[model samples]
Structure formats: C-alpha cells, structure tokens
Target: MGDDLNNDEGQLPRRDLLKSAGVALLAGAAASAGAAAAQTSASAPAPAPAARSGKAVGARLQGVQHFGLTVQNMDRAFEFYTEVLGGNEVMRDGDFRGEKIHNTLLTDQEIVARERGVNPRTIGVPDLKDGGQRLDVRFVQFDNVVIELLQYRDAQQPMGSGDSWAEPRDHMSPAYPRSMHICFYIRDDVDFNTFIRDLEAESARRGMTQVKANRVITVTSEQERQAAPLDANTNRITEGKSNGWSLIYCKGPEGEQLEFVQALGPVKKTFEDAMAARRRMLAAAGG
Candidate 1:
C-alpha cells in the first residue's frame, strides 16, 4: 500500500504506474474473454432471494483479496511492507506461467495487472534472467486482505498509456487531477483519525514529508456515481454499507502521488467490489 516512489507532474510516477497496472491485471483476470466464456458455460440460475433484495449483489466482494504495487527495490519494499506496514510474507519464486514471473503470492503483480488491461509480459520482466530486468514481487497478507508489492528493476522503462501522469490530456482517466489518489476505509471517524495520526507518525519516523491531509467532496458522473456513492450533505457514507473503506493520499518517496482508500457506502462499495459484483451478475445472466 505504501512505497518509496516519486510523485511528480507531467509524468506518471513509477509507483502510481505500478499500482494502476496492478489493478488492471486484476480486472483482466476477472473479465478476460476466455474467463467470461468459461463462466458462460458453467452458468447457474440465481436463487430467488439473491435476485430479489439485491443482498446477493453485495455478497460477492466479501474481503480484500489482493492489491498490487510497483517499487524500486524488491528487498527494501518487501521488508518495508512486512516490517513497517505489518504484512506477512507469503511466497517467492520465478517464471510464473512461463511469462518470466519472479515472485508469486496471493497478492502479486500478475493479479493486479490482469485486473486492468495490461499483459504482464508487456511490463513484467520476471527473473532478472531476461536482460537482468526482473520485477521484484512480494505477497503479504494482513488478516483477510492480501497486498502484492512489485518493483520493476529497470527504472528507465516507460510507465504506460492509461496512466494519468503518462497521459495528462486524457481527462477521462482517473489521474487527471495532478494528484491522482485512492482511499481506503476504516471503522469510523475515530479510526480515520487514528490512521492519520499513525501515518503521520510513521512518516516522521522515516524522515519522509508529511503531505497535506484534507477532505474534498465532488460530484461524479452517473456511472461513477453508481460505483462509489457519497452522501449528498456530508459526502461520506457508512463503512459496512459502503464496504469498510477510507482514503489516504500522500506522495511516495520518489514523489509519485499515491492513494490508499477504505470504502464506506453509497449503493456499491469499493471500485473493485462494485466491478466484481457487476461482472458476477453479468456472468450469471449469461452476458
């Protein structure tokens, strides 16, 4: 969730690029043409209860399965996530699926990147064996959530196209605000306050800049509105209804804009949750 990547304008910071790529990976895995076709063949009829009150819609995204990020050094990133953020190491290896994968875990770059649209072979080098360019990957689990850490060995590689920093003119993309960020949800405002305090304290201890922290409420499109809703007045929702989530925005060590979000409600929960739910419904309906 946190790393030492740069945050700068005009170009997608390496860390943000990695995280975004990771999400893309997860998306792809769930929606690939082959996966969709398989689901269509094995499709089953929905229970009447699940079809009625819509609770079935909410049952899909039960836990934080996994998340991916790119870092500068695998060893340092692995140590920081495990030691600093309190994640447990799960796996380490090389050449996953003959695609030159270096590390494999419940939460790894492959999982993250597949969620988006990027192919791992396009961005991941796997084991330094391919011209000594390997993506340092780590899978860490905290309770039910799985976090994947990815560090591409080559620093000079181009980030990607859909990235905000990499494509500023694409206001249609999420990173257009210059400070593209994501948020995670905590139990309540009390938990929110504690997280801020802890984050600041950690930042100070690490000699990192404590970036400004504030809240902003903005109107979203109908499609966007449906995915992550906000209360009209306070612009905040309950965590359970919204899926225990919140937001943490800060600059990584390399000056890359980063966002850690915790979900709390307005119709659907986290972006991933909502998307997954939609996919499930669509798959069930034979779409």
Candidate 2:
C-alpha cells in the first residue's frame, strides 16, 4: 500500500516519512531530557504558567489542533519531531475515506485555529497533480495558538523559496523573510525560554545550524481585532498603529520553522475565553 501510493510519478511518500520521523524525534527528546536533567541542576525550579490579565477583548484560541505537510524521509523526520522536539504519537489511522494516514500530536501552550465556518475540504488538503506531494502537517498546541509544521515531499512542489523543505538542503532550509510561519504563545517566559534553549541544544546535538534571530511583525484590522484579540496585536500593522502580534521564530528538527510569541496584552490568552464570549452573546440574544 505504501509503495503503491508513493511510487507514482511526482508522488513523494511524505506521509510515510512523517510517521517514521515523528516517532524517532519524540523518542530522542525523551531520552535527551532525562540525560540532560541528570547532568544539569536537578534542583531547578519547576516551570510556571504565565500570568493573565482579566480583560475581555474577544475570543481566545485553544492552540493548534492539526496541520499537514510533506516530507522526504519519514523515519528521519519522525525522529526529529518526536525524540528531538518532544512530540508524542497520539494515534495512527487512515484519513476521512479510510485512506491510511498517520497522526501525531505535540504539547503546546494554547490552541489557535477555530472553525470560522470555512469548508474543511477547501482548507483541509491541497489538490496535487498525479504524484504531487501534499503538505506534511504536524500539530503542536501552545499558550496562544497551534504551531503547525509544513514540509513538501516532492522536490518539484514549489514551496516559496527558502522554506523548510525547498530542494538543495534536505534538513535545513534558509529562513525566508516575511514568510508565513506558525507562532506559539507560551505561558511563562521562563518556560518559554527553557523551551528555546532545549530546541537549540537539540539542534546542536543533531548537528544542524541555528539561523540568525529575526522577529516577525503582524498587523491586525479593527474588525479582526474584535474577533481574535490575541492575534490582532500581533498582525503586521503600519507604523504608529499597534502591531497586534510579535513572534520569535526558530526552526525545529529537520529545519521546520517554529515561532514563540508573546501576547500583545490581555485579549489573546485562552481559546476558551473566545468561545465563552460567543456563548454569552448568544444567550443574551436567546439563541
């Protein structure tokens, strides 16, 4: 079955690669953490959650639920995400039509994407040509939004230049300027900092180069601000206006871009907050 799906012209056996890499990456992370803790300060304080302000601007996101991507080597990618990045394999199954598929979930601080009445099929998967590769998606929940890793399997598949999976470099891709990168909000700055350090160490251990530190700026419109308070401030905006969002970008194992963000202020903390507000409005209207 795997070969049938993968061997087709232009078809890149990405899903299979993702599954293999996910398992190996997670295993490596667990082992590394244990060994590092044993050597490092065992007395280090337990990580703490960030403080939140009680201002209701709009809704809060639950964090990233799921995403899809393509990959070259499932086994290598699996090890990078699972062992090096600390993601656990939640379940393995086929897609909606019972097509064989692999699903893995990672712990993030919050959820980001919501069902904004968009058709799932439209945003769900891309229509690729025969043997064309689909987006290799990986999910990670964080404090503010879900972090998704997207890798294209077929080298011919045009991911913008410098993307994680662009040809030439198999594992690391040059960080592109102003590209769409997934951002993850963390609760405590301390924990967030530690997570970055861990990622850096993991990259070093795997002999991958860490890219220069660059921040991504986003602007939010007033309407968008009212809808998703968390992201509004982070969105790229004109100077003098509040740039609702800010993100520190990094790369995970196998060169997948990762973003760690700090909420602009009060509005973008929890996904539950957004849902609660909607419920309250609906109740007032007697819905």
What is the lDDT of every predicted structure here? 0.45, 0.39
TM-score of each: 0.41, 0.38
Q: Candidate 1's residue-wise lDDT over 60-146, tens digit each?
A: 333356776654445544554554445567876432232333443323666777887786655442434343443435687554446
User: Of the candidates shown, which would achieve the greatest lDDT relative to the real structure?
Assistant: 1
- The whole-model C-alpha lDDT of candidate 1 against the native structure comes to 0.45
